[model samples]
Target: MARPTFRELTAQALSSVEHGYDLLAPKFDHTPYRTPDRVLNATVRVLRPYGPFGTGLDLCCGTGAGARVLRAVCRKRMTGLDFSAGMLDRARSAAPDGTWVRGNALALPFAPGSFDLVVSFGAHGHFLPRERPRLFAAVRTALRPGGRFAFPLAAPARPGTPAYWSLLAFDTAMRVRNAVWRPPFVMYYRTWPLTDVRRELRAAGFGVTLHPLSELGVRPDGSPRCRLVLATRLPEHSG
Candidate 1:
């Protein structure tokens, strides 16, 4: 895929999230926003020991990057769902063997106990903090007892660092843009803190654990640069 031009990205940034992704779909994999192969490979390697899962779902699966991970770990079947039809179209072509469905993450269209493993990649920024409870509840409802939900959460950049300042600037600019714009493009790097996420997952009936993605290496602080969050759905009877 060719990289989107400056003009193209500017157009996308101005459009609504769904319309923006639709416009960018053809060139999405070439964008930096696409989940890197290193991340996907690390996720697959770390998840292999837990799987050979019966069925899997890739929530908000954009262009099927997570589906590729699911393919390696899931035995029975894999499904990818996203709200953007254009993304689902690209995902279908990229991984024709897997099932692709168009749906919102806050209200997953699958039945209760539909999957044994659910994974998401690079789609959290699309959701707002207020929407997380409903989003997690939907995922929990879609997973069977003992099913797992996994996603990578990177350690936040230290204050005063270039990366930290850059992310802060970008988020601030987005807040200003959304303040004046209609149908905001909600992608903030700092909103989904790991602490809040863990609390919410436990509240939603998932027992959460963190596995360091050591392959991605550690930060200067000796913390893993990224950790994979594995949230298992607790049985109805268990705490």
Candidate 2:
């Protein structure tokens, strides 16, 4: 299938959140912005060796993309959680077998040590840097001791490429929009840098590791353009 044009996708993205996604939901699967199946398959491949996890959760599981990944890795039960009713509606249609919940990431409804594994895809930009520790801690409290929370993080855009400039413009525009608009549409491409993310995860009681998705290939600098960040809660905390 031919991918949707960038203009069409951008048009939907710029509208109000619910209305924008309600419009995009129908064609979202055909867009590059939808977590690529290659990335999903690669994540499943890496997670397979370690899992057979009992219960799994997909946070901000837009259209159930990460739920599909968890379905392959988890053994018993799986769930997809998101705040967007439009997104959840699409996700429910895609994965009828998995549980779906609508709620905020900062205060997940599950009790402490509830899930064995939790994963999210392409949802971090919706959160600001300061909100990360709370988000990570919430995920940690929802997981069992030694439970793993994982997600893919791509390398930063290179300084002068069109991709880089495009992202900068988009983020700048979002800032301007938020200044003039109400209930800000919180998305920024450059805010959640990986180094800052790692520190926040550690502060949230997780020991983190990085695994290169070598299948995605390397950048001009010979570094992997895509990698997974696996953050596991420690079994015990030191005083």
lDDT of each candidate versus the true structure: 0.92, 0.86
Off by over 4 Å in 2: 1-19
Give lDDT tens digits, candidate 2, residues 1-239.
46657786767656766566666776777876799888999898878877889999999887888887887889888988888787889899988999999888999998789899999999888898889988998999999998999999999999999999999999999999878876467878898788999988887888989999998999998999999999989866530
Reference-based TM-score of each model: 0.98, 0.92
Model 1 TM-score relative to the real fold? 0.98
What lDDT tens digits, residue by residue, belong to model 1 across residues 79-133?
9999899999999999999999998899888899999999999888888999898
Candidate 1, after superposition: displacement of residue 154 in Å?
Answer: 0.4
Instruction: Highest lDDT: give the candidate number.
Output: 1
RMSD of each: 0.9, 2.2
Q: After superposition, how far is residue 70 of candidate 1 from its true place, in Å?
A: 0.7
Count of backbone collisions in candidate 1: 0
Backbone clash count for every predicted candidate, in the order shown: 0, 0
Off by over 4 Å in 1: none
